[model samples]
Target: MVSKAMHRIDQQVPVLPIGDGVARSARQQQRSPYLYTDDEIQRILHAALLYPSPKASWRPVTLFTMLVLAYCAGLRGGEVARLMLGDVDLREQTLEIRETKFFKNRRLPLAPGVMTSLKHYLVVREQAGAPTNPESPLFWSPQRNCGYTVGGIRLILTDVLRRADIKPARGAVGPRVHDLRHTMVGHRMRDWYKAGINPQSKLPYLATYLGHKDIRSTLVYLNITPGLLQDACERFRKNGAAAPQTRESLP
Candidate 1:
């Protein structure tokens, strides 16, 4: 439009800087996800449990449970923050995630170990005089007297990450809270490879487990890490050296 206006007036058209094109291209590329190792996760959990908060007596246990649920359940930060006490069914060992990213609800079964952790947290929370009403927030903050907002969860996790040495204390460039979801997917795929299970066949189930609308969205979270690569290579070699079966022996 500027160039056309200049042409009408018979004036010179100023050239735009080439840097705009370069910046636009950079914006279009997806940032690489940071995958946390099992050891790093343990360290973060330990740090969260030791986090200091003078106002909130239940802070330590709440933060610890929040991180565990986010990773173990492959839940988004908002999903974790929005969880209500009613959504967690200890008897059934399941969590009902309501109104997720795709505006769909999903119920996830908890592993035995995860259920044990939740029970312990609930016990401690009750001792701390936190609310036990079904409509109460699963993880509550004394300061807010309500469920944590998405931003609040991010701020807490950022501090824990810094304390765990998983991220620099003062930098914006580091692993994000959302990376926990990505790490969960990558770890699951690697475990499947190690167990000689066909990960390709499990993709759909994994997608649904993560509350993804399709496998393509889930694929974005599957980072190719060194451990995953090694396991995949080992699986390939084992299959290659296996004895060939006759057509009559095929299942």
Candidate 2:
């Protein structure tokens, strides 16, 4: 197998970094990521929490927990699906995301409300008699008897979005479930900018939290709009021409 051959070669000689090996095609412009508004996010969560039940299924709690984590932590759907019981520390209010995209591990802290929901889910899960072993999946499926799959989670999210009446922009490609991660970053930047904080100074922290390889990757998630531009112009005027250029105005 190629993997075995690569392993054997690696043992004999250090493997050379081949890079991604894909050629970048020149495009007219970068595709913008879709961002969710606060009301839409609330509706989405409400729909997820109200996922229809046979009156006893744990699907509602599982879906709710998954959505909250994805939005708050900027986690990829697969990362949420792959979480294990040992990865979550309710006491510490942190999640250990292990061996994720780019072969990196990171720690994600939960918001207080999110942690409360997780604790409530855990209580429900325990009462339902789901396995609580460290290696067991943190988000388990009662019917499938396994951890939630990426496809499964996607389907649920799609359904939740539909129920919430959140639609993609006319002729736009996205508003994909993964856009929740984009929304988190974009919203954070907007908040910082509105607060007169320099978002550029905090880019690295956001990059680390989102498990991006570098700030360049983080920058791809930011989309400048007329509103952001207007805010920057207003801030400049307020500062009497001494205002620093904001990250939003950077090329």
Candidate 3:
């Protein structure tokens, strides 16, 4: 977790620098991959989303809604804290990010599958007589003034991670929400590749869509795997390039 002191600094820091670091990491890791094995990430997100929790009478709908928004929309923990009852448009199939952690605004396009689930959830919400106003918060917790906190998001997934028994490879960092952001980027890149999309050119669009200030901030999500790394090394040679290496985090 970022200490409040760190958060204050990050808030003041220019986002482009963050993007630069992200891009440099990707370039540096061309020889060695610096990411979870695909299976590990898949296991973590699925387990977290599926793990059952003690639902309030309205929790089933709220929980499902939160999962769909977080996974499909790629919202950060704080943007989610600001989700309002009317921020979502089930009919329009898009949602607006008012103000985000990095101070970027975006409109996340939704697909039909997610829309279907969201509609189901909204119905339950309506049955429970929830609000449909832009003013009212979409997800409220009795404990929080506005919405869920970083710690809350962490606890939610940590409990599920324990259930799934997913651990870091020896000497790897434990998984976290930012990891979910990484996983989503990796998944999208794979999809673009499969669809004959030129990843280099497509990256800017993806960056904008993901609410990144610039492509550099978005490129960190592109750290490749061993097989992809081998392919890069065969074509491009960079002096002193590192494999995607991860430093160990203290337990």
Candidate 4:
């Protein structure tokens, strides 16, 4: 096998070309995460709510609730898919995410308004007589008799983006459910800057909130956008912060 040959060559050559090429390819193929503006988020949510009759009649409420949670909580699609009925604590305004990405558990506090919306969704679910057992999925699907699959959610999200008239150019990646997390981070960072808070100091808390094992992992979620860049630069100028001058080392 090529892998075995690579192992053998490692002992002989002290280095491998395969790994370098793969790393280079990965760097070249990396795509930026799509960041949604406030208007775009509202538009997408509206589109989901307006999803056509019949098939989507069963889904509008569920999809809208899911979108709110994804954007507000910055939950990964898989984490959102795995939520159990007992995981959501309306009284405490918290979500218990268990055995997530790194086999870690975390509690995420909800915004007051987001909590209210979730309470409304729960009331509707109860009226519909959807399952309420502890083991039952928080987001139930009438079609699946269980929680929505991550892939299923992604497919639905793609359709919603299309309906919202959001299309990525040719050969470019479009918005996805996961991008909601990125958008959440970006928006939060922008807000922190505007509020005169040091985002760097709060990154550890954000990492914990997002269930990332290390701060390094959380950094990947923070993408720089034009608006974020402009706002940050303006804040810096307002604060009278100066760029550090670099000193050349003597040759």
Tell how far residue 170 is off in model 1, in angstroms.
1.1
Which candidate number has the best lDDT? 1
lDDT of 2 by residue, 1-251 (tens): 45557879687655554433321212213545678888989999998888897855777887888888888889999898889988989779999998789899999888899899989889888877779999998888767678878898887787778778785434224467888998898788778879998788999999999998999999888877666677767776877655354644678
lDDT of 3 at 89: 77
- Candidate 2, poorest ten consecutive residues by summed lDDT: 20-29
Candidates in order, TM-scores: namely 0.86, 0.79, 0.65, 0.81
* Residue-by-residue lDDT tens digits, candidate 1, 123-146: 887777768898888887656667
Best by TM-score: 1
lDDT of 3 by residue, 1-251 (tens): 24545657778743333466776667555533234556765565466456664544655355556655665666776676687777787768888888875786777888898888777766776666555667777675533435556667656655555556664433223554455566667766666655545568888888887888889888767867665555445434332233333223323
Question: 1 or 4, which is superior by TM-score?
Answer: 1
Give the per-residue Cα lDDT of candidate 3 at 227: 55
Q: What TM-score does structure 3 among the candidates reach?
A: 0.65
Provide backbone clash counts, one per model.
0, 0, 5, 0
lDDT of each: 0.86, 0.81, 0.63, 0.82
Candidate 1 — which residues are off by over 4 angstroms?
1-29, 243-251
Order of models, best TM-score first: 1, 4, 2, 3
Better of 2 and 4 by TM-score: 4
By lDDT, rank the candidates, best first. 1, 4, 2, 3
